[model samples]
Target: MKYLSFTTNCVLILSFVYVVNCANILGYFFFPGKSHQFVFQPIWKELALRGHNVTVITTDPLNEDIPNLREINVADSYSVFLNHEFSNVRRESTPPYKMILFYQEVFVDIFKMQMENKEVQDLLELPKNAFDLIILESHNKMAFGWKHKFDAPVVALSSFGLPVFSHYLHGNPIHPILYPDFLSEIRECTTLVDKVESTYFTLSCWFVVKFLIGPEADALARTYFGNDMPYLDDLEKDSMVFINANPIFSDRRPKTPDVMEFSAILPIRDTLTKDLKQILDNAKEGVVYFSLGTNVRFDHVQGDVKKNIMAALGDLPYTVICKWESESIEGQPKNVHLRKWLPQQAVLAHPNVKVFITQGGLQSSEEAIINAVPLVVIPFLGDQPLNAKILKSNGMAETISPKELNRELLRDTILTVARKENYRQRAKELRDIFLDQPQSGVDKVVWWCEYVIRHKGAKHLRSPAADISLYHYFMIDVIAVFILSFYLTFKIIQLVFAIIVGLFRRKPAEAEVSRKKKKKN
Candidate 1:
């Protein structure tokens, strides 16, 4: 009896320990951009640190030898950028659908390459029930089906703010008036016409994703996940939660509780390099930093645009540091300093760095605000225009459309923001607000991640609207019923009135005929 009691205690202790350390997470972040990768890498890093066996298939793989870390690096896809996958994004004023189609074409190729790669395929071919959770980048829908492959719960990573289609996937409310469509340039202060335009853009994007992009992704996923797996579209709706990069400071819109925003995850630099610090410390006239994020390289800019930008920077009294890819920029300004790459967050944090001339990428915009640096944004493609517009609306930045950009305008815009203390003040205010969160972005992600694991994928956190059909979700059929009933009622009333008037007119005509007949008699 004594030996039996001792054995039972040992068994109970062992079970407790196993339960405490039970999570094998697989993260797929195979999007081909540094900015997108930057947003998600930290989440996996923290998960690994917390003793979760985390494996990530990424373009930017882990460099260190961390315990419980596995990486399947497909950096070869960098050639896609070199081959100009995002070229001629806005050569003409293309509509939003065409723009999405263009990106979808590029993304589909990237997805196929990643999945067909031996390493990723090997991971998939592993025995069933391999992982406890799967985190997929929400941009490319191909890998969302990995949930079925591993028989684990899924969590989606949204690099930017959620678009209309993404909201539909997760059952987040998308009010056209309150939240403007992601692609369109409409904002909160829109008129009836603007609302109509925004709603149309939202509907069109939903259709394109459902009929066009969704099918492409579903077919690709079915190819590997087996036809027996739940459809990719269905699996996508079952995502446990969405970790979005949109902070409350960036856009003060309503959000579902299931969506967590880790906006500052990308640019959290606590220290600056010695040389960069020295340059900023010595610049009494102030400093301006310019970089078009990672996607749009400086070398790809047209010669005329480059020349004009250089000339404008040259005229600035402040020292200008630009991220230029070439060894030398022709007609480079005396005051301008060009480097192949600069530590963007460190430079933005410098006290002397006044105005950030950026491509208005969401990460860059958030970084600038976090560091209290105002912006002069030149949006080129994707959601840059929307970011610039909202930042300008918040009075923390000024915008110059690429088409409207010139040497004089660009120079003046930079100087205006640099000299104006209001932009700086507003940026500082937002920075304080952004920093006033209950916990840091890293902490929030790590906590929520563990919570999900502990709760067995946290299905209780999921919104039930995600399971409803699109027609029912939007109440399109209900609206159709109301419209049809009103139309029928209006027709019935019109017919009854016409019949009553005809009867009265016929009686008057009959009386006249009878009087004429009496006269004849």
Candidate 2:
């Protein structure tokens, strides 16, 4: 009896320890851009630091060497599509639209490849009950399907701002009016026309994704998995989504239920070099730093636009550091220095660095605000326009459209952004707001990791799959109602016209008989 009791106690203790120690997390990170990788790295590192066995599948290699973090290279076949040839694809003449299409095609193809590859299959074949949780990049929309294959909680990380997704997880509308237009800072309330436009944009995007991208991905997934492919609904059902967005930067941030905005994940390096310290401490004239982001090529800018920016900057008395990739700026001003690469954060932190001329990438925007530097945004593609709009709305930045790139305007905008102390003050205020958040992005992610471990699975918090549908997900029902209403009105008019014609007919039966007699004759 004594021996049996001791054995039972040992068994119970062992089981508890095993449960506590077992945390296997797989992270699917398919973002191709360096900036995106940088944004997500801190959270990934944090998860690893917390003793969770973390696996990262990525297009770009990560810089950190954490023992628990496992790196898997997911090949990107869409290298041919990227506008700027950074590492691969030598040819450079492809049009932007064609390039975008090519990118879509390649992403579908690669997703299929990843789904079908022997290594990936082997990895998935690992006991479905093995992993504690799966974390994926939200942009890899297909990752949502893995929920069924694994007995684990799923989490999505958005490297960009939150908009459509707030509705996906929380069943709440992130009002489009919240995203301010760059040209107009005043709260532009959503109008009927704006709603219509938003509906059209959402539907158009859905149509493209479903008809163009979804079919191929579905076919590939089905072929590899030997089962029906998981649909968009499946993706949404399995995961708790989070956006890397700061409410302080957004114009009118909507309160969301499930999805949380933890934008402070972009970690600032605390330790500064003596030289960097001196640069910040011993500057009489203010400094200006410029970077066009990783994806954008400086050479792609038209000669006139380039000349205009250079000419405008020539008049500015501040020291300018431009991350220009081009061979030479022959008639460059003495105040401007061109470099292939510069210490971006160090420059931003410098007390002398008063203004930032940027491509309006999220990471750059976040960095500027964190370091209390005002912005002059030259937006290119994707979320840059939205970021620019947000910054402009927050009174922290001024945006100049790529189309309106000229020396006078460029100089004027720079002068306006730099001269006005309001932009700087707003940036500082946002910095405080970001810093005051409950926890750093990394810490929030770590907390989630532990929560999943404690709970076994965070299924209680997941939004119901039945609540979301294709038409409902994109708010297509609202559009359909308007269309149906118009059609019904037209049908009613046609019916009334037919009735009126019958009533106006002078002796219908006699007229019909006469017509028949004439036909017989």
| Per-model lDDT | 0.80, 0.68
Q: Write the per-residue lDDT of candidate 1 for residues 1-521, one digit (tens) a residue.
A: 99999999999998877445758999998778777787788889888887889989999886778978999998878777765545347523776678778888888878888888898989977977899888878877888888888888887877776668877767777777777766676656358887877777777778898899888888888888888887677787777555444443234555566766675445453466687677788899999999998888756766578778888999899998888887476678777878887788878877899999999887888888888999999988777888888889889899998877799999999999999999999999888877677776767777877777778878787687877886897799999999999999999999999999999999999999999999999
Off by over 4 Å in 1: 1-19, 85-92, 243-257, 265-273, 474-521
Clashing residue pairs in candidate 1 (N, C-alpha, C atoms within 3 angstroms):
none
lDDT of 2 at 310: 81
- Which candidate ranks first by TM-score, i.e. highest? 1
| Model 2: CA > 4 A from native | 1-20, 60-65, 73-106, 109-127, 148-151, 163-166, 174-193, 223-229, 250-257, 270-283, 326-329, 464-521
Model 2 TM-score, all chains together: 0.74
lDDT of 2 at 491: 99
Query: What lDDT score is found at residue 247 in candidate 1?
Result: 46
